[model samples]
Target: MTTSFAQVMIFLGLGIGIIILLTAVFRVHAFFALLIACFVVGLGVQMPVAAIINVTKQGFGHIMQSLGFIIVLGTTLGVVLEHTGSTKVMATYILKRIGEKHAPLAMSITGFIVGLPIFCDSGYIVLSGLNKSLCRRTGISVVIMSVSLATGLYSVHCLIPPHPGAASAATTIGVDFGRLILVGMAVAVPATLVGYGWARYAGRKFNNEEPGQAPVVDLSLPTPSVLLSFLPVIVPILLIGIKSFIGIDANKPVPDWAGLFMVVGDPVIALAIGIIMALLAVRSWKKSTVSNLLQEAVEKAGGILVIIGAGGAFGAILAATQVGQHVSKVVNLQALGIFFPFLLTAVLKTAQGSSTVAIITAASIVQPLLPALGLDSEMGKLLAVLSMGGGSMMLSHANDAYFWVIARFSGLDMRPMLQVYTVASLFMGLITLLMVFILSLFLL
Candidate 1:
């Protein structure tokens, strides 16, 4: 019944390899791929067939229970923002305040803030016009404009919750969502800057290709005010942060008013409140329009939800093998600490090119290893979640859909895209990892 460390590692490698080969090479759907991986690892570890089946179902359901509604609520909020033109309103407002001279910086900031509520691909598409218009008007290189915006969005997408990767990781590792969000935002700020800085510097080295024509903005539609544009995003974060802070000092006497914040600040309730705020910006209250929009958000979240569930199943099987205990006894992974997750995730991200898959898979693998690696502490787990996020952003190339999104949207060719944005992603990932490592030293 005792599986050696080498055997555990071999089975683990085979399971992960199966995932990469099927997903990256054969182009199999991730949900099926992950399910197959769970079976492979389960069989390799000599687990009972019935146990494996039950574990898979349990793992999948657990992830769904934790993240399903939050993901849908967050996705719905994003859909509302997109349909109501609130994203553009926020982007335009920033562009005007920052002016054309600092257009790249303005675009980066816009992407960072807007990206909090939406996926990176959609965020880029929605704002690509503004990026192009800024480039044309300011005569900034399209390379700089595109990378700045892309990196800014990329920065937050990898690390933050309600964004799938980080959210799933938090659920797997049992970290506080509020703390993860606050810490994730802290790490994201520097990563965003590194992307911005790299874009401005390396973007000039490439030929300053003229950006494509800006997309026509629909001027007739009434948009949300800038202040109103910010509320939905900011309010949930504040509520979550306040609740987290109160809980941090459990010894302190709790306040009477804190009870209300606790309810509103729960991640699910917070995001639901956000959805209500997002609805306020909707110009049309028609039953059809609202129904269609909600449907769209659900549709968007559906694929993500399943993939995350599969990832959870995979991790459960991996954990069932007692691999973490074996590895902990055999090696000094504790010394490696945060870097283990960072490297594993970077490899997965580079291999498969889906940050969500990369982070979710990596977190599943790492979750079992946490106690052995001396990362079972609360802060250690938070940094681990972040470190996986750091890895998920590196080396975006042809395999990455987001890379192509930036490529086609900015009209940048492959060579330039690799040189500018791809390289920037590597730098961004490194800087983010380094930041996480330093935080581990202090906090862990």
Candidate 2:
């Protein structure tokens, strides 16, 4: 059954709006809100109501099948890295290079680079914690440092594809991975700079009242090998991009290594590789038993896994309900294609406080409309991904996890945290939008 623009809009708004409203009001998990929205919209639209209901199960199951293991693995590695002080070492290396004179810029770059492969929440768990320690030493407020780190992470996580969120968006819209990376970089650099400017200016205004005090990283911590440290993250990225750009086909057998790449490129597989490799890298088994590090990894991954799974459920329902399609049509009728992706996703992010759901919902809705509008799927997908990133960065207030983390770390009051973290996110996101808009004109 074909979904027309107006009908799509009515259902889409009703469905997505209800989810957003419920998320805000009831504080129900996004996953539940999305599922409810799906049921409501599907029934209202009279879309194979029974079948659509069944499809919801498949949709959520598909996400779990694809991503369950990966989130766990990522969580484990993140926890171990934090406990091991690898984060501190990396920060130490970066801070030394940038020096106190431009540590903020350095943090921004480091955060951006690290965030490309890692999720923003994970990055914050590591970077924000480290940044706060640095703040105490340098007399810099935790607020300034946290914003710098968050800004950096936000740019890469949002703009770059293949970090689960963008990868999901890309698949939904049939976008080429290479195009996302190429075009993403074009937008990312400017976003980084703008975020940097905001962080630095705000940092200076706060005047490091908290004092600079990067806790001396205890080097005795059990660190992993450099190769193992970077392998899983680097390897999968290479595979997806090369395969996408080169157009490897059925006629030619995939090289053995390429097949391995494909296996590892699976989000679940890639992160699992990292988890297993981390065990070896720490030399836990070779030295003796592997209890401490292994257990730590599992523990760390628990919260992240629940949240990710819930996010997946939410996204699945959004697609199943077809509200996204409806909303995109309303957008099309207004000739608002370029901004529709951004505006729609931003509303979700602002109202619901879950960027993952915002990106996923927008991409799913926008996906069904690409051909009808004669639009490039890549354009719509990439825009939707970045738009969610932008909106998520728009306000780092109490609703945001980063808000409390930054406030607690820096020992700053709510008012000042807003000045540094909240405003910096807005500035950087705006710059990112500008870059995306300009590039979309040429690349799309």
Best by lDDT: 1
Residue 374 lDDT (model 2): 41
The TM-score values for the models, in the order shown, are 0.97, 0.81
lDDT of 2 by residue, 75-109 (tens): 56555555554554566677887896666776777
Candidate 1 deviates by what RMSD?
1.5
lDDT of each model, Cα atoms only? 0.90, 0.62
Residue by residue across 1-444, what tens digits does model 1's lDDT show?
Answer: 567788888988998898889988989989999999999988888898999999999999999999999999989988888877889989999988998899999999999999998999989988999888777788889999999999999999999989999999999998899999999999999999999999999989765697764456453447888877888989999998888988887688778979998889988999999888888865657787789889999999998999999999998888888877887888899789899999999999999889999999999889988987789998999999999999999879988989988888888898889988999999999999999988987997
Candidate 1 Cα errors over 4 Å, as ranges: 213-221, 251-253
